[model samples]
Every structure is written in C-alpha cells, then in structure tokens.
Target: MIYSIFTALSWGKDLTHLFKRIEESKIALAIFSGKYAQSKWCLNELAKMKTLAEKNKLKVIPIFYKVKVDDVRHQKGEFGHNFWKLARTSSGEEIKQWKEALEFVSYKMGLTLCENRYST
Candidate 1:
C-alpha cells in the first residue's frame, strides 16, 4: 500500500488520525519525512509512533530524507566516513541522546527502522 509523507510525519499533528488511516489502508510501510524531523521534538515523537505500532501490532517502515549516511557512527568510532572527527566533535550529551534514542526505538518497536539491511 502507498502512504503519503504528510500522514507519516503527522505524529504530533494527528498521530491517531494517521494510525487510523494506516490501519484501514493496506500499506506495509509508511515513510515519515520532513525538515522538522531533524529536531529533538521529532525524535521524541518517533518514539511515540513506535509505541503506537507495538500496541496495534502494526509494522511501520519509516523513511527519512536529508540524513546523509556519513553523519552517524558506532561506538567503536566506526561506520561513518569521518569517524575520527565526528567522534571527537560529538559531545557526551549528544552521544548519550543518540544511543538512548536508538535503544528506545529498538526496544519499543522491535525494529531497527534504520537502513541497516546490509547487516543481515
């Protein structure tokens, strides 16, 4: 099934509305995209979506744009291209938030959501 970006990123605006639409629709994946998603507020909102999906037993595929692959790194200072510099520049708070977000999404949703398909 096809889902519009408008509905995907409607967590804060109208998450229940969006979920109702998703439940009625046949879409296996939904893509959430927007510039506002880069903010901390959006991150918390996504955690909410994961909760909604779990409670409803729905599978959601989140699609993000403008987040370059080279922007993220693993704890071993690996993954991203500029690993050394990125690790050095990233503050403890930033890293903690990133890890916490990752853990929350993974534990709550039972899915990575990120495009880590190559890991398999």
Candidate 2:
C-alpha cells in the first residue's frame, strides 16, 4: 500500500510531492536500514512523520532492518559513522532535524530483524 503511493513518482523525482503524500497518510512505516541516515530524503520524511505523529496522531511504525535501535538513537556504530560524515556537509538546522527525528523514532517500540535473518 505504501509502495503504491510511491509508484507514481519516478527516480530522482521531487521530494516535495512525497512530503505532501506523507502528510496525507494516516500511517507511516519507516524502515531504518543501515544506510537510512545517509539519505537526506529519508531523514526529511522521518521528520515529517514525527510532526504528523505529534500533531495529527499519525501512526508511525519503525522497522529496524539489520540495524540496532541504539545505533540509530545515539547515532553510533555504522549509522553514526555515516551520519556524522553527512553532518560535515549539511547545515546545522538540517542535522538537528535529522537527529531529532532519529531520536524520536528510536524510542518507540519497533521490530528489529537480525542481519542474518534477511540475508540469503
């Protein structure tokens, strides 16, 4: 269902439209994988999801795939390494928003899939 909404957009499409769709969604499922923080778009979506959750009671379900919740929350381990690398080139406000979003989602109860579980 979520992918259905995204199917209309092509690769490298404008994110503004995606953000609008996110605002309209009743539920948002964020899959925080190893490279999640590396993508600014993902972080922006997470930030919007957090705002929606706070103001509109939008349900946010985070699925940690091959990543630890602690790593995401504290920005440690591989996720931290990459995030900090990104922070070096990003604006302060942008990093702040990403950090807040990661912290907010990490605290919520979510499912974590072990690295081996999804590997062939």
List lDDT for all candidates, in order.
0.41, 0.80
Candidate 2 residue-wise lDDT, 8-27, digit = tens? 56247787878777766777
State how far residue 9 of model 1 sits from its true place (Å).
12
Provide the clash count, candidate 2. Answer: 0
RMSD of 2: 3.2
In the range 1-120, model 1's lDDT, one tens digit per residue, is 343454555556655566565555433332223333244444444444455465765455534333322232132223233333343666676545544443444332222234554210
Write down the worst ten-residue block by lDDT for model 2. Answer: 1-10
Residue 68, candidate 1: Cα error in Å is: 3.8
Provide the TM-score for each candidate, comma-separated. Answer: 0.34, 0.87
Clash-forming residue pairs, model 2: none
User: Which candidate number would show the highest lDDT if scored against the true structure?
Assistant: 2
**TM-score between model 1 and native:** 0.34
**lDDT (0-100) at residue 41 of candidate 1?**
40
